[model samples]
Target: MATALQAVEVIRDLRHSFNIGRLQMCRADEWLNALLAERIDSGEKRSLRSSGGRKKLQKH
Candidate 1:
């Protein structure tokens, strides 16, 4: 049926869009990590709070 075909097309489009969005998120996370790595100091301790939880990167 025509209606069923249309529904399939819409679902395909949505899946493609979701994949693109996930790729963008991965790139953004990589960029942010690179930026953070540059500002961290070897002598001091700091916590990086992200979506999962807080992680201790260094010790004072």
Candidate 2:
């Protein structure tokens, strides 16, 4: 769940990376994956911090 700002930033980065990849003749998928992973990890860290480092358990 990326915020609006984060989403916009991702889009901007994607375009930049795409152009660089094209100029360098490299694959964009790898770059895209790394960027997405970084964003996800950061989002997880933010959520954890917001919850005071305590996660609630769910019952099955």
Candidate 3:
């Protein structure tokens, strides 16, 4: 899991092309969750679920 400081840094880097101040106004969990959800939806990433749960995970 990312520390709050690390998450902030990530959000900062991602905001380089946008409004940093506005980006900073978002809650860290909200940003992180959205990023993860996007990656998962793209089918380019493996779910973090254990192998035993992977079959179930694929239902998503």
Candidate 4:
């Protein structure tokens, strides 16, 4: 029946749109995670440098 075919088409379209939105969200999450990782890495490096300086000063 035409009505059944139309219903199927609508469902297919909705599923396709949902998948696209999901993919976009996944990409955004990846970008945010990468950004956070970079910030954490830099913070660790800064802390290490400061700690090393303190150790040297204490020894002297």
Best candidate, TM-score: 4
> What is the Cα-based TM-score of model 2?
0.32
Q: 1-60, model 1: which lDDT tens digit per residue?
A: 222224345645765777657676557556645545643553222423321112232221
The sequence of per-residue lDDT tens digits that candidate 2 reaches over residues 8-50 is 4676687687665464434444564564466467676455335
TM-score against truth, every candidate: 0.35, 0.32, 0.34, 0.39
lDDT of each: 0.44, 0.49, 0.56, 0.50
lDDT of 3 by residue, 1-60 (tens): 553345557777777756657645567557667755665687734543323334433555
State model 4's lDDT. Answer: 0.50
Local error of candidate 4 at residue 44 (angstroms): 7.0
- Which RMSD values do the candidates have, in order? 15.8, 10.1, 9.3, 21.4
Error of 3 at 46 (Å): 1.4
What's the CA RMSD of model 1 in angstroms? 15.8
Note the clash tally of each candidate. Answer: 0, 0, 0, 0
Give me the runs in candidate 4 sitting further than 4 Å from their true place: 1-20, 44-60
